[model samples]
Target: MQYKPASWLAAIPLAAMMGVCVGQAGPSQVGPDPTLPKPQRGLLPDMVIAKPAPWGDKTPTVPDGYTITAIATDLKIPRQTLILPNGDILVAEGKGGNAPNLKPKDVIAGIIKARGTSSVKGGDRLTLLRDTDGDGNYEVLTFAENLNAPYGLALVDNNLYVANQDAVVRFDYQPGQSKASGPPETVTPLPSDINHHWTKAMTASADGQYLYVGIGSNSNITERGMTAEVDRARVWRINARTGEHKSYATGLRNPTALTIQPGTDQLWAVVNERDEIGPNLVPDYLTSVQEGAFYGWPYSYWGKNVDERVRPQDPAKVATAIKPDYSLGSHVAALGVDFSNEAMGAQFADGAFVGEHGSWNRKDPVGYKVVFVPFRDGKPFGAPVDFVAGFRDKDGTTRGRPVGVTVDPKGALIVADDLSNTIWRVTPTQAAKSQQPVAAAQ
Candidate 1:
């Protein structure tokens, strides 16, 4: 296939091309290091993308003594998954975003990104997969149809909330129904202006009184002006009954996945931080979201590290920036997070599983697998460990890209692979007790 760049992209300065050779330390080194390096600016950000190489008969490689099998396949852009109470798995499958290309670099970047993604159209609906027998295979059924780019799923009481691109809607949900009986009712309007970062990651409070939704920044560093970012780069707290909402937390560039820690009311997020500074300057993180706290975006990152790119800098605001608890490495693009309780086995019984959808801004690509960060006393304790890998080949061709992750009713790990259009289930092998730990990729 012949690929052509936009005419304006040809006008990018030669200086932008010069920084392409600059290299940074490995991802593992940056994850645990407290001292962050100064930002590296370039005319254009490094773009070493892995082209999609669909899996024919291959499967993702898991840790030793763990078996991986496809529970559901032929999904259309399955971005997130939710395990219902009755053992049925609900998959949110859709894609919708139309941010204008305001800069010449944006046009070129878009073309490069589209090449790496699957050409399949999004389903724009949620699908339910039920494993009828004790076996691993699932019977697919359409749970809901005609959704407007639905990405987030939260069930509160008998109300199922779907965060569409423009609004949060509610549906009457029954315990064992295969489909919703009627049309959904609009709960509240979400910020759809410019529609830059469209994925709204949402979760309900344990008591089902409030819903928390993550809204991402409209631009990398507010180049389009802060006015375009109203109620964005933050998490919103909404009343489940009345749909009244307020900003819960601010300054998160992209909190792609939100979940409440079991046994605690505290909410946690897996954030995708800002990019284009350097290969390893700002690391995406997993952090406990404090109500009414600022995380620092467009101005500073990782708490008080001022990004010189934003004009009219606010030193006072940077001073109040709170650092994240754990770093997942720069540009990892972490999109899914779930805590492990009564997990698959003893090995995974005490940690969080994060699905890294992979990276495009670094010279060396990272994060095409699922990782586990051990937690003790409700806090991330050790370095992340690789739970599943081999998404990208030795030559950098991508066999799959992992998105949403959840623990099923049977205590198995379920991963959504959008690029390969499949959902993978991982279980502990019979001999898992005798195998060594798998070291995570940096």
Candidate 2:
């Protein structure tokens, strides 16, 4: 697929379809709503809420009693993020360490070199640590080297499991190790087919027993099927202790986020839908992952319903796959996801937050913000609500694109923005205070 820069307003059609009024520059879309309830105050605009040195893209407006702060900046190329037990954050920057020395021609050369298996470009891994109290700034804690598009990360016990482009490896992670402690352990030797290598997204169970990895399909929808030898649009569960692996479920085009529910241990995968189909055709989805179940990819989509355009190749198999539970907008490109437990504030007690990476294929751009999917008894209820927005400016220019999301130990939301190479910390007032211990009587 070829990529060309287009007006960011292309995403307006999607927003309008969702009942959001697109405002013109001179006048607000809804006009002065004296009669309509006032937009509750305390919600900071993009400029004010994001403080100190607000980067590109004008400031955004937020809801009541909440604020956004950029805890770090000048990151090379931030991707997936994980909050360590000790409060330090772990970030996965894709091919970023090589940024300082790489030129435009070098990047083009790297892409061309990436065409074959023998070509190995270096400098893909680095870890940033926010030492707030020490020096009041975030810095690189570790500068790891020689990784191939490393994306997914899971810290089990003292071991850090990483999903490289071709295999899953483990490194001994000391609580404060600046470098990998021991030799790399090759857990799973995946097929290193350079073509469809979606081997970069995964998450581990809270208990640290199993690791869920997403190996997205090579093609939009393979003509053979999603399960053939090379067609890998599925999630796999690995025994964290033994390295044994099994297919957790199947048929998701790119189930980027694989999160295990806090209390129930149930697994959920937020998948990005297939592209090229008309605007609202195939719904991108967030759903519970059942073991041994097929999720309808390739020959089928959105459940057992066959995608006529791609179904002729596997007419016999569509009868078995299951449909998705919740449908996000088509081609919105939902990626990072995490569930908010009761510890988080009242509003997010039992909700799931997703970071939509934004769309390039649609006539209009879609998904450059965070959305919340409410859950009752561990199941999604009603439609998803917009939790965080305003990644694009009023003039339709995108300044940041959210890729990974995780709730911090203090219950604040942590989002990784790839475009700005920064991480945003979203905290609700009273929520952090609730986490603090009662002061001594004085």
Candidate 3:
């Protein structure tokens, strides 16, 4: 079924229907707001899409001490990034989802959402980038081609694991190699049928003994039924050698990105909570993922805040729901998260950098850039600082939206801009003083 361009007209009445007042909840309501308003259901979720406007000669704005530059451009939907031991950057460039439209509204919503994404087809491969001359600019090369839509990347020992949409696959990795020559070996099958949230965020343990995969729920509040949510809305821990897997954490609607905190064994996740529950009800969060902990998905949110819309409720399940550690604001769509232990400069050296992919379900768009959430003693400390901005222009046109983020070997920040198909490099002016050559593949 083709999505009509005029389908957006169907969403125009959403603001009045929901009584949406933009900025009702300001930045004060961002982190762990003590007062969360009651959920307000709308017949159709509010649609505020930022139309794509490619970055002509402009770059993203950064904080005073930091500068932004484009390292590579003309990529096809780069989502996540992995910095190799030899300083080579591996970019997973693809997008894949086949969730069927459940209603007429779904069709209209799909059309509006599609308008925000890149028009170019996905590359469906891992592209390698290397700054051979110690310059900020990178020389791009195709590392591997003709694969599924890969999202997460993890390198353990000599094995590189790729979290494809449907499965986790393993490939042989060499220290400075630009290409992965052999076919991939499937490690474990991921739940992908009726994939409402298709991204499978994966991270490996520091010892390389275990793998963690984040699988999102099938639909908002299980509207698609519980049968579609089996083995989902949770993080799966897999044996790197045996492929044996079990649920590590549960009840997260969409844990978009996962990472292991440095100097500790604790695992953390950035979750995208459910929508259609007012513009400021459920807040997206970043929390430490505990083994077997339930963070509350369809039945509840933020501890025991029961979502009445999830019918045939389970009071027992809601009682077991654990509250998230910190909230990143409602509809922020916190996607990419990484610690700053190995990051450059003092300002960014103690926190997590999160890539906010922006929001479409709110009357006012939020989270169009990257932010830094400070950490003290391995826990979130203060308010989130806006590290990168300028994704959305004054007229609300999106020049680019950030997805996956990583810190290069020299500690410079690397951001994958999917809308503009560009990889941006952020470096402190001081760090740029000592340039180091990127080792070229033999």
Candidate 4:
């Protein structure tokens, strides 16, 4: 897990960054108002890259009431998943991002990050899984082929939309069909230029009239310059019916996952914050997506706390930064999130499930599992409870990395593990047999 310090790290003064703590953050770092520590710029940033480990007969550990199963294996880098109306599951498999490394540190960081990820090539297609006998076992089938690194998917009014690395494409679907009937049509093109944060996370409005796309910044703190960040780090609201798009909000560095809170039209996002200042200097968060609100990227983090490294700082923008609603801890790399439902059982019925893809840096590893953050009155509160874990062994070796999480209406949690090229289905112990009508009851 140790990495030789890059020669460029010598530029940082040891004294300025030496005193900060390098272990896991306490509870104060897990909720709203996370205690922000002083930025600790270090010589190489205490690099910890988890080497790949085999799972063999091991599986992720869920809470006592639930059991986890690998419904589909040997995928092509599954990143996100969607549950269809007819009880089918759609898997988005791909990897992208062509952001050129701005400095030597970028290259070094990239090399180290790759060590923890799946080496398989992206399928670049949508795969459908059908529970043919109304049982847990799934029959894998191809829904569509030849996609451009499809990452985010949504279905509205029989129109399936996929957020590709460069554009939003749509496919017409009919109930019970296991595959797409025709080729995908581009709804709109996205800002693909130098996609430092290539994931175009997406979600549709509850009414199915609008599609909100979360576009990330072109560089960490705009090192690529503001010109490269035009129309980046913001959510775009697209008219689902007409294909027209406009900026809905601004300054969110990398909103990795987006969802409409189960009962409300309000959009929510799990954002991945900037890094390198300190392991816990800036915390990744889950927040309500407010229209026309700026969440502060590059200039500030966690609302109004200025990051000194962003050149030509915008004090005005910093002042307008909207503080996030909840913090999910730093460098957790939450790649997936879905609001919980009745099928998840009472304890998890009113919350959101976050799939932390695990961290690639920091003195100690964090994440590598799925967690449930309870919510009341549609607002998140309390510390996150580990619902699916054991992806990282006690020795810090990476076994699997969870990406997108989806709550199946038929009573289960669908998890995408790109690190192992698998799709895991987690259901309450014996709950599926008797809880078939639970979602409707609620």
> lDDT values of the candidates?
0.84, 0.64, 0.85, 0.86
Off by over 4 Å in 2: 1-54, 57-61, 95-123, 132-136, 197-199, 223-231, 431-442
Alpha carbon lDDT of residue 291, candidate 2?
88
Query: Which is the winner by TM-score between candidate 3 and candidate 4?
Result: 3
Tens digit of lDDT per residue, candidate 4, span 1-442? 3434556456645432232246554445888889898888754555676778878999999876688899999999999999988889999988898876666666667877888888899999999999899777889999999988899899998899999999999999899889889998999999998888899999999999999999998887888889999999999999987889999999999999999997789999999999888778679999999999999998999999999999998998888998999999889999999987776676677789999998766766788999988886678767788889999986777889999999987678999999999999998765433432222333
TM-score for all models, in order of appearance: 0.94, 0.76, 0.93, 0.92
Model 1, runs deviating above 4 Å: 1-20, 26-33, 433-442
Which window of 10 residues has the lowest lDDT sum in candidate 4? Answer: 433-442
After superposition, which runs of candidate 4 have C-alpha atoms over 4 Å from their true positions? 1-27, 430-442
What are the runs in model 3 whose C-alpha is more than 4 Å off? Answer: 1-23, 431-442
Model 2 over residues 347-418: C-alpha lDDT tens digits?
666768888876543334567788877777667765566667887654445667788899875767888876
Residue pairs with backbone overlap in model 3: none
Q: Highest lDDT: which candidate?
A: 4
RMSD of 3: 5.2
What C-alpha lDDT, on a 0 to 100 scale, does residue 260 get in candidate 1? 90
Q: Name the 10 consecutive residues with the lowest summed lDDT in model 2.
A: 42-51
Residue range 1-442, candidate 1, lDDT tens digits: 2334545556765444333577555536334345577788866787766778868888899876789999888889998888888888899999888888876677667766776687889999999998888677789999998998888899877898999888999999998778889999999999988888999999999899999999998998998898998899999999989999999999999899999998888999999998888888689999999998999997899898899989989999999999998999888899999987554656666789999988877777889999988877778877788888999886779988898898775678889998888999888866764443222121
Pairs in steric clash, model 4? none
